[model samples]
Target: MAMNFFDQFDIPYILGTPLVIPALLFPVLMCLTTNRFLKNRHMTIQSWLLNKTTKQLLEPINTIGHKWASMFLTLFLMLILLNTLGLLPYTFTPTTQLSMNMAFAIPAWLMTILVGLRNQPTSSLGHLLPEGTPTPLIPMLVLIETVSLLIRPIALGVRLTANLTAGHLLMQLISTAVLTIMSSMTTTAMMALITLMLLTGLEMAVALIQAYVFVLLLTLYLQENI
Candidate 1:
Protein backbone atom coordinates (compact mmCIF):
# COMPACT_ATOMS: atom_id res chain seq x y z
CA MET A 1 0.00 0.00 0.00
CA ALA A 2 1.24 3.43 -0.90
CA MET A 3 0.89 6.27 1.58
CA ASN A 4 -1.03 9.36 0.59
CA PHE A 5 0.12 12.69 1.98
CA PHE A 6 -3.41 14.07 2.01
CA ASP A 7 -4.78 11.08 3.91
CA GLN A 8 -2.86 12.12 7.00
CA PHE A 9 -4.75 15.43 6.94
CA ASP A 10 -8.14 13.84 7.58
CA ILE A 11 -9.38 14.89 11.00
CA PRO A 12 -9.59 12.06 13.54
CA TYR A 13 -10.57 14.03 16.63
CA ILE A 14 -13.33 16.44 17.56
CA LEU A 15 -11.27 19.39 18.81
CA GLY A 16 -8.32 18.89 16.48
CA THR A 17 -7.11 15.42 15.28
CA PRO A 18 -4.46 12.70 15.47
CA LEU A 19 -2.42 14.57 12.92
CA VAL A 20 -1.49 17.01 15.67
CA ILE A 21 -1.43 14.49 18.49
CA PRO A 22 2.31 13.71 18.48
CA ALA A 23 3.24 17.36 18.49
CA LEU A 24 0.85 18.06 21.33
CA LEU A 25 1.86 15.01 23.31
CA PHE A 26 5.61 15.66 22.99
CA PRO A 27 5.47 18.98 24.77
CA VAL A 28 2.95 17.82 27.34
CA LEU A 29 5.09 14.84 28.28
CA MET A 30 8.14 17.07 28.53
CA CYS A 31 6.32 19.48 30.81
CA LEU A 32 5.08 16.69 33.05
CA THR A 33 8.53 15.14 33.35
CA THR A 34 10.05 18.52 34.12
CA ASN A 35 7.53 19.14 36.89
CA ARG A 36 8.15 15.72 38.40
CA PHE A 37 11.92 16.20 38.37
CA LEU A 38 11.62 19.64 39.91
CA LYS A 39 9.61 18.15 42.78
CA ASN A 40 12.27 15.50 43.52
CA ARG A 41 13.97 15.83 46.91
CA HIS A 42 17.50 15.61 45.57
CA MET A 43 16.97 17.48 42.31
CA THR A 44 17.70 21.17 42.64
CA ILE A 45 19.42 23.56 40.22
CA GLN A 46 22.11 24.38 42.79
CA SER A 47 22.76 20.70 43.50
CA TRP A 48 23.02 20.04 39.77
CA LEU A 49 25.91 22.46 39.34
CA LEU A 50 27.90 22.19 42.57
CA ASN A 51 28.09 18.39 43.04
CA LYS A 52 31.41 17.20 41.56
CA THR A 53 31.73 13.59 42.85
CA THR A 54 30.92 10.82 40.34
CA LYS A 55 27.71 9.88 42.10
CA GLN A 56 26.98 13.55 42.79
CA LEU A 57 27.61 14.33 39.12
CA LEU A 58 24.96 11.82 38.21
CA GLU A 59 22.68 13.41 40.78
CA PRO A 60 22.97 16.84 39.20
CA ILE A 61 22.15 15.40 35.77
CA ASN A 62 19.21 13.61 37.35
CA THR A 63 18.19 16.72 39.32
CA ILE A 64 17.49 19.21 36.53
CA GLY A 65 17.20 16.38 34.00
CA HIS A 66 13.50 17.16 33.67
CA LYS A 67 13.86 20.66 32.26
CA TRP A 68 15.81 20.46 28.98
CA ALA A 69 16.24 16.72 29.24
CA SER A 70 12.54 16.09 28.81
CA MET A 71 12.41 18.29 25.75
CA PHE A 72 15.49 16.65 24.25
CA LEU A 73 14.33 13.09 24.82
CA THR A 74 10.80 13.79 23.64
CA LEU A 75 11.97 15.42 20.44
CA PHE A 76 14.45 12.66 19.71
CA LEU A 77 12.12 9.76 20.38
CA MET A 78 9.13 11.24 18.56
CA LEU A 79 11.05 12.08 15.42
CA ILE A 80 12.81 8.72 15.32
CA LEU A 81 9.58 6.81 15.87
CA LEU A 82 7.69 8.75 13.27
CA ASN A 83 10.46 8.38 10.72
CA THR A 84 10.92 4.66 11.27
CA LEU A 85 7.18 4.02 11.32
CA GLY A 86 6.86 5.62 7.91
CA LEU A 87 9.54 3.31 6.57
CA LEU A 88 7.26 0.38 7.32
CA PRO A 89 5.66 -1.28 4.25
CA TYR A 90 2.89 1.32 4.28
CA THR A 91 2.56 4.18 6.78
CA PHE A 92 2.57 7.95 6.71
CA THR A 93 4.98 10.04 8.77
CA PRO A 94 3.36 12.97 10.54
CA THR A 95 6.69 14.81 10.56
CA THR A 96 6.55 14.91 6.76
CA GLN A 97 3.67 17.36 6.95
CA LEU A 98 4.26 21.09 7.18
CA SER A 99 1.34 21.55 9.54
CA MET A 100 2.75 18.98 11.96
CA ASN A 101 6.24 20.43 11.72
CA MET A 102 4.85 23.90 12.29
CA ALA A 103 3.06 22.62 15.36
CA PHE A 104 6.43 21.59 16.80
CA ALA A 105 8.38 24.62 15.61
CA ILE A 106 5.86 27.22 16.77
CA PRO A 107 5.92 25.87 20.30
CA ALA A 108 9.71 25.87 20.29
CA TRP A 109 9.81 29.46 19.08
CA LEU A 110 7.20 30.50 21.62
CA MET A 111 9.11 28.73 24.37
CA THR A 112 12.19 30.66 23.35
CA ILE A 113 10.29 33.93 23.62
CA LEU A 114 8.64 32.86 26.86
CA VAL A 115 11.99 32.02 28.45
CA GLY A 116 13.39 35.39 27.37
CA LEU A 117 10.39 37.24 28.73
CA ARG A 118 10.39 35.28 31.97
CA ASN A 119 14.10 35.77 32.61
CA GLN A 120 14.73 39.25 31.23
CA PRO A 121 11.54 41.16 30.65
CA THR A 122 13.37 44.46 30.62
CA SER A 123 16.28 43.43 28.46
CA SER A 124 14.30 41.21 26.10
CA LEU A 125 13.76 44.14 23.78
CA GLY A 126 17.47 44.68 23.65
CA HIS A 127 17.84 41.30 21.93
CA LEU A 128 16.17 42.83 18.90
CA LEU A 129 18.18 46.02 19.13
CA PRO A 130 21.83 46.83 19.45
CA GLU A 131 23.01 48.85 22.44
CA GLY A 132 24.11 51.84 20.36
CA THR A 133 23.05 52.80 16.86
CA PRO A 134 22.08 55.87 14.87
CA THR A 135 18.39 56.87 14.76
CA PRO A 136 18.05 55.84 11.10
CA LEU A 137 19.67 52.46 11.81
CA ILE A 138 17.16 51.75 14.56
CA PRO A 139 14.33 51.33 12.03
CA MET A 140 16.44 49.00 9.91
CA LEU A 141 17.49 47.07 12.96
CA VAL A 142 13.89 46.64 14.03
CA LEU A 143 12.90 45.40 10.60
CA ILE A 144 15.78 42.97 10.52
CA GLU A 145 15.04 41.71 14.00
CA THR A 146 11.40 41.23 13.20
CA VAL A 147 12.26 39.23 10.12
CA SER A 148 14.84 37.19 12.03
CA LEU A 149 12.34 36.34 14.78
CA LEU A 150 9.69 35.41 12.24
CA ILE A 151 12.16 33.19 10.39
CA ARG A 152 12.84 31.03 13.46
CA PRO A 153 9.60 29.07 13.32
CA ILE A 154 9.56 29.04 9.54
CA ALA A 155 13.09 27.68 9.36
CA LEU A 156 12.44 25.11 12.02
CA GLY A 157 9.25 23.88 10.35
CA VAL A 158 10.73 23.82 6.85
CA ARG A 159 13.89 22.03 7.90
CA LEU A 160 12.14 19.07 9.45
CA THR A 161 9.32 18.80 6.91
CA ALA A 162 11.60 19.21 3.93
CA ASN A 163 14.14 16.66 5.13
CA LEU A 164 11.55 13.99 5.88
CA THR A 165 9.51 14.65 2.78
CA ALA A 166 12.56 14.61 0.55
CA GLY A 167 14.03 11.51 2.13
CA HIS A 168 10.80 9.56 1.77
CA LEU A 169 10.34 10.70 -1.80
CA LEU A 170 13.88 9.76 -2.67
CA MET A 171 13.47 6.34 -1.11
CA GLN A 172 10.29 5.78 -3.06
CA LEU A 173 11.96 6.76 -6.29
CA ILE A 174 14.89 4.45 -5.61
CA SER A 175 12.58 1.57 -4.84
CA THR A 176 10.67 2.17 -8.02
CA ALA A 177 13.83 2.23 -10.08
CA VAL A 178 15.10 -0.95 -8.46
CA LEU A 179 11.84 -2.76 -9.12
CA THR A 180 11.99 -1.69 -12.71
CA ILE A 181 15.51 -3.05 -13.11
CA MET A 182 14.71 -6.27 -11.26
CA SER A 183 12.03 -7.12 -13.84
CA SER A 184 14.79 -7.62 -16.48
CA MET A 185 17.14 -9.90 -14.49
CA THR A 186 17.03 -12.11 -11.35
CA THR A 187 20.40 -10.85 -10.08
CA THR A 188 19.05 -7.31 -9.99
CA ALA A 189 16.67 -8.28 -7.19
CA MET A 190 19.60 -8.79 -4.83
CA MET A 191 21.08 -5.45 -5.82
CA ALA A 192 17.73 -3.77 -5.32
CA LEU A 193 17.40 -5.33 -1.86
CA ILE A 194 20.85 -4.14 -0.93
CA THR A 195 20.05 -0.63 -2.12
CA LEU A 196 16.86 -0.61 -0.08
CA MET A 197 18.78 -1.73 3.01
CA LEU A 198 21.36 1.01 2.56
CA LEU A 199 18.67 3.61 2.07
CA THR A 200 16.87 2.46 5.18
CA GLY A 201 20.03 2.84 7.25
CA LEU A 202 20.64 6.30 5.83
CA GLU A 203 17.05 7.31 6.54
CA MET A 204 17.39 6.17 10.15
CA ALA A 205 20.53 8.27 10.57
CA VAL A 206 18.84 11.25 8.97
CA ALA A 207 15.93 10.93 11.36
CA LEU A 208 18.21 11.00 14.40
CA ILE A 209 20.36 13.81 12.99
CA GLN A 210 17.35 15.99 12.24
CA ALA A 211 15.95 15.49 15.73
CA TYR A 212 19.30 16.34 17.30
CA VAL A 213 19.72 19.45 15.18
CA PHE A 214 16.26 20.69 16.07
CA VAL A 215 16.75 20.11 19.80
CA LEU A 216 20.27 21.55 19.77
CA LEU A 217 19.07 24.71 18.07
CA LEU A 218 16.17 24.98 20.49
CA THR A 219 18.47 24.63 23.50
CA LEU A 220 20.82 27.26 22.07
CA TYR A 221 17.93 29.65 21.56
CA LEU A 222 16.70 29.16 25.11
CA GLN A 223 20.19 29.59 26.55
CA GLU A 224 20.75 32.76 24.54
CA ASN A 225 17.41 34.36 25.41
CA ILE A 226 17.25 33.20 29.00
Candidate 2:
Protein backbone atom coordinates (compact mmCIF):
# COMPACT_ATOMS: atom_id res chain seq x y z
CA MET A 1 0.00 0.00 0.00
CA ALA A 2 1.18 3.54 -0.73
CA MET A 3 1.95 5.69 2.31
CA ASN A 4 1.10 9.03 0.78
CA PHE A 5 0.75 10.87 -2.48
CA PHE A 6 3.65 13.12 -1.44
CA ASP A 7 5.97 10.20 -1.95
CA GLN A 8 5.51 10.69 -5.65
CA PHE A 9 7.46 13.92 -5.39
CA ASP A 10 10.30 12.33 -3.43
CA ILE A 11 13.71 12.28 -5.08
CA PRO A 12 13.72 9.00 -6.94
CA TYR A 13 16.50 6.46 -6.59
CA ILE A 14 17.63 3.50 -8.63
CA LEU A 15 18.69 0.17 -7.11
CA GLY A 16 19.06 1.63 -3.63
CA THR A 17 21.08 4.58 -4.95
CA PRO A 18 19.99 8.20 -4.74
CA LEU A 19 19.52 10.01 -8.05
CA VAL A 20 19.24 13.66 -7.15
CA ILE A 21 21.91 14.92 -9.49
CA PRO A 22 21.26 12.47 -12.28
CA ALA A 23 17.58 13.35 -12.35
CA LEU A 24 18.45 17.02 -12.58
CA LEU A 25 20.90 16.40 -15.41
CA PHE A 26 18.53 14.16 -17.37
CA PRO A 27 16.32 16.98 -18.62
CA VAL A 28 19.37 18.86 -19.82
CA LEU A 29 20.24 15.93 -22.08
CA MET A 30 17.14 16.60 -24.18
CA CYS A 31 18.59 19.67 -25.85
CA LEU A 32 21.92 18.51 -27.13
CA THR A 33 23.66 21.24 -29.11
CA THR A 34 24.81 20.83 -32.67
CA ASN A 35 28.18 22.42 -33.27
CA ARG A 36 27.39 23.01 -36.93
CA PHE A 37 23.77 24.24 -36.40
CA LEU A 38 22.05 24.08 -39.83
CA LYS A 39 22.34 20.30 -39.99
CA ASN A 40 19.70 19.84 -37.27
CA ARG A 41 16.17 21.25 -37.20
CA HIS A 42 15.79 21.16 -33.39
CA MET A 43 19.09 22.92 -32.89
CA THR A 44 18.08 25.61 -35.35
CA ILE A 45 14.76 26.17 -33.60
CA GLN A 46 16.34 26.24 -30.15
CA SER A 47 19.02 28.71 -31.23
CA TRP A 48 16.42 30.97 -32.82
CA LEU A 49 14.18 30.84 -29.74
CA LEU A 50 17.08 31.51 -27.40
CA ASN A 51 18.32 34.49 -29.41
CA LYS A 52 14.81 35.98 -29.63
CA THR A 53 14.19 35.51 -25.92
CA THR A 54 17.57 36.98 -25.05
CA LYS A 55 16.88 40.08 -27.11
CA GLN A 56 13.52 40.58 -25.40
CA LEU A 57 15.03 40.20 -21.94
CA LEU A 58 18.02 42.50 -22.44
CA GLU A 59 16.38 45.14 -24.59
CA PRO A 60 15.55 47.45 -21.69
CA ILE A 61 18.89 47.14 -19.90
CA ASN A 62 21.76 49.59 -20.15
CA THR A 63 24.77 48.71 -22.33
CA ILE A 64 26.85 47.45 -19.40
CA GLY A 65 24.08 45.09 -18.28
CA HIS A 66 23.78 43.61 -21.74
CA LYS A 67 26.74 41.33 -20.99
CA TRP A 68 24.70 39.35 -18.46
CA ALA A 69 21.89 38.69 -20.93
CA SER A 70 23.36 35.46 -22.30
CA MET A 71 23.71 33.95 -18.84
CA PHE A 72 20.14 34.83 -17.90
CA LEU A 73 18.77 33.56 -21.20
CA THR A 74 20.53 30.23 -20.77
CA LEU A 75 19.21 29.94 -17.23
CA PHE A 76 15.68 30.59 -18.44
CA LEU A 77 15.94 27.89 -21.07
CA MET A 78 17.28 25.33 -18.60
CA LEU A 79 14.55 26.17 -16.10
CA ILE A 80 11.74 25.93 -18.63
CA LEU A 81 13.04 22.61 -19.90
CA LEU A 82 13.34 21.16 -16.41
CA ASN A 83 9.89 22.39 -15.41
CA THR A 84 8.31 20.89 -18.49
CA LEU A 85 10.19 17.61 -18.06
CA GLY A 86 8.91 17.31 -14.48
CA LEU A 87 5.36 17.17 -15.81
CA LEU A 88 6.09 13.79 -17.34
CA PRO A 89 4.91 10.68 -15.50
CA TYR A 90 7.40 8.89 -13.22
CA THR A 91 9.89 11.75 -13.23
CA PHE A 92 11.20 13.89 -10.41
CA THR A 93 10.84 17.68 -10.43
CA PRO A 94 14.05 19.23 -9.14
CA THR A 95 12.56 22.72 -8.81
CA THR A 96 10.16 21.16 -6.32
CA GLN A 97 13.15 20.76 -4.02
CA LEU A 98 13.61 23.85 -1.85
CA SER A 99 17.35 23.29 -1.46
CA MET A 100 17.97 23.12 -5.18
CA ASN A 101 15.90 26.22 -5.85
CA MET A 102 17.70 28.07 -3.05
CA ALA A 103 21.05 27.01 -4.47
CA PHE A 104 20.02 28.72 -7.68
CA ALA A 105 18.32 31.72 -6.06
CA ILE A 106 20.82 32.64 -3.36
CA PRO A 107 24.01 32.87 -5.40
CA ALA A 108 22.29 34.66 -8.26
CA TRP A 109 20.55 37.12 -5.93
CA LEU A 110 23.74 37.70 -3.98
CA MET A 111 25.68 38.31 -7.18
CA THR A 112 23.18 40.94 -8.22
CA ILE A 113 23.41 42.63 -4.84
CA LEU A 114 27.18 42.56 -5.09
CA VAL A 115 27.01 44.11 -8.54
CA GLY A 116 24.77 46.89 -7.25
CA LEU A 117 27.00 47.53 -4.29
CA ARG A 118 30.07 47.57 -6.48
CA ASN A 119 28.68 49.80 -9.21
CA GLN A 120 26.38 52.17 -7.34
CA PRO A 121 26.86 51.80 -3.62
CA THR A 122 24.72 54.78 -2.78
CA SER A 123 21.77 53.73 -4.87
CA SER A 124 21.99 50.14 -3.59
CA LEU A 125 22.00 51.09 0.10
CA GLY A 126 19.26 53.59 -0.58
CA HIS A 127 17.04 50.60 -1.38
CA LEU A 128 17.21 49.64 2.29
CA LEU A 129 15.72 53.01 3.25
CA PRO A 130 13.01 54.59 1.20
CA GLU A 131 13.06 58.24 0.18
CA GLY A 132 11.28 60.98 2.20
CA THR A 133 10.92 59.03 5.45
CA PRO A 134 10.04 60.90 8.62
CA THR A 135 12.65 60.91 11.43
CA PRO A 136 10.73 58.79 13.94
CA LEU A 137 9.88 56.04 11.45
CA ILE A 138 13.25 55.89 9.66
CA PRO A 139 14.89 53.30 11.91
CA MET A 140 11.91 50.92 11.83
CA LEU A 141 11.51 51.33 8.07
CA VAL A 142 15.18 50.57 7.45
CA LEU A 143 15.03 47.41 9.51
CA ILE A 144 11.92 46.22 7.73
CA GLU A 145 13.32 47.01 4.33
CA THR A 146 16.60 45.31 5.19
CA VAL A 147 14.76 42.17 6.23
CA SER A 148 12.80 42.23 3.01
CA LEU A 149 15.95 42.69 0.97
CA LEU A 150 17.58 39.66 2.60
CA ILE A 151 14.48 37.53 2.09
CA ARG A 152 14.35 38.09 -1.66
CA PRO A 153 16.26 34.88 -2.37
CA ILE A 154 14.09 32.92 0.01
CA ALA A 155 11.03 34.29 -1.74
CA LEU A 156 12.45 33.31 -5.11
CA GLY A 157 13.20 29.73 -4.03
CA VAL A 158 9.92 29.21 -2.22
CA ARG A 159 7.92 30.64 -5.09
CA LEU A 160 9.31 28.10 -7.54
CA THR A 161 9.14 25.15 -5.13
CA ALA A 162 5.62 25.90 -3.94
CA ASN A 163 4.18 26.42 -7.39
CA LEU A 164 5.77 23.26 -8.81
CA THR A 165 4.98 21.18 -5.72
CA ALA A 166 1.34 22.28 -5.70
CA GLY A 167 0.87 21.51 -9.36
CA HIS A 168 2.52 18.09 -9.01
CA LEU A 169 0.44 17.26 -5.92
CA LEU A 170 -2.80 18.21 -7.63
CA MET A 171 -1.96 16.16 -10.71
CA GLN A 172 -0.97 13.16 -8.62
CA LEU A 173 -4.22 13.25 -6.68
CA ILE A 174 -6.36 13.51 -9.78
CA SER A 175 -4.53 10.72 -11.58
CA THR A 176 -4.65 8.42 -8.56
CA ALA A 177 -8.36 9.02 -8.15
CA VAL A 178 -8.96 8.32 -11.80
CA LEU A 179 -7.03 5.06 -11.57
CA THR A 180 -8.68 3.90 -8.34
CA ILE A 181 -12.21 4.29 -9.63
CA MET A 182 -11.73 3.27 -13.22
CA SER A 183 -12.67 -0.41 -12.77
CA SER A 184 -15.92 0.26 -10.92
CA MET A 185 -17.03 3.44 -12.66
CA THR A 186 -16.28 3.78 -16.34
CA THR A 187 -18.27 6.98 -17.05
CA THR A 188 -17.01 8.79 -13.93
CA ALA A 189 -13.48 7.63 -14.56
CA MET A 190 -13.63 8.83 -18.14
CA MET A 191 -14.78 12.27 -17.04
CA ALA A 192 -12.08 12.44 -14.39
CA LEU A 193 -9.45 11.35 -16.88
CA ILE A 194 -10.55 14.05 -19.29
CA THR A 195 -10.29 16.61 -16.52
CA LEU A 196 -6.89 15.25 -15.64
CA MET A 197 -5.76 15.66 -19.22
CA LEU A 198 -6.95 19.24 -19.31
CA LEU A 199 -5.35 19.94 -15.96
CA THR A 200 -2.07 18.53 -17.30
CA GLY A 201 -2.15 21.01 -20.15
CA LEU A 202 -2.58 23.79 -17.60
CA GLU A 203 0.31 22.45 -15.56
CA MET A 204 2.54 22.52 -18.62
CA ALA A 205 1.66 26.18 -19.07
CA VAL A 206 2.36 26.80 -15.40
CA ALA A 207 5.79 25.23 -15.75
CA LEU A 208 6.75 27.53 -18.60
CA ILE A 209 5.14 30.57 -16.99
CA GLN A 210 6.86 29.94 -13.67
CA ALA A 211 10.21 29.71 -15.43
CA TYR A 212 9.55 33.03 -17.16
CA VAL A 213 8.46 34.59 -13.86
CA PHE A 214 11.63 33.40 -12.15
CA VAL A 215 13.87 34.76 -14.89
CA LEU A 216 11.90 37.98 -15.20
CA LEU A 217 12.16 38.74 -11.47
CA LEU A 218 15.89 38.08 -11.60
CA THR A 219 16.22 40.44 -14.56
CA LEU A 220 14.33 43.11 -12.60
CA TYR A 221 16.69 42.63 -9.67
CA LEU A 222 19.65 42.92 -12.02
CA GLN A 223 18.14 46.07 -13.49
CA GLU A 224 18.03 47.66 -10.06
CA ASN A 225 21.61 46.60 -9.34
CA ILE A 226 23.13 47.51 -12.67
Q: What's the lDDT for candidate 1?
A: 0.68
**Backbone clashes under 3 angstroms, per model:** 0, 0
RMSD of 2: 1.9
List model 2 lDDT by residue over 1-226, tens digit each.
Answer: 3459788778888998777777667645655544654658877886788788888888767789989987797788878877887876666788888998999899989988999999999999998888999999999999999999899999999999999988888888888899999999999999999999998999999998888888888888888888
Q: Quote each prediction's TM-score.
A: 0.69, 0.92
Q: What local distance difference test score does each model get?
A: 0.68, 0.85
Cα error, candidate 2, residue 211 (Å): 0.8
lDDT of 1 by residue, 77-155 (tens): 5666665666766455767878877888898779878877887887777878888888989999989998998799899
Error of 1 at 146 (Å): 1.2
Once fitted onto the true fold, the runs of candidate 2 whose alpha carbons sit more than 4 angstroms away are 1-3, 27-33, 39-41
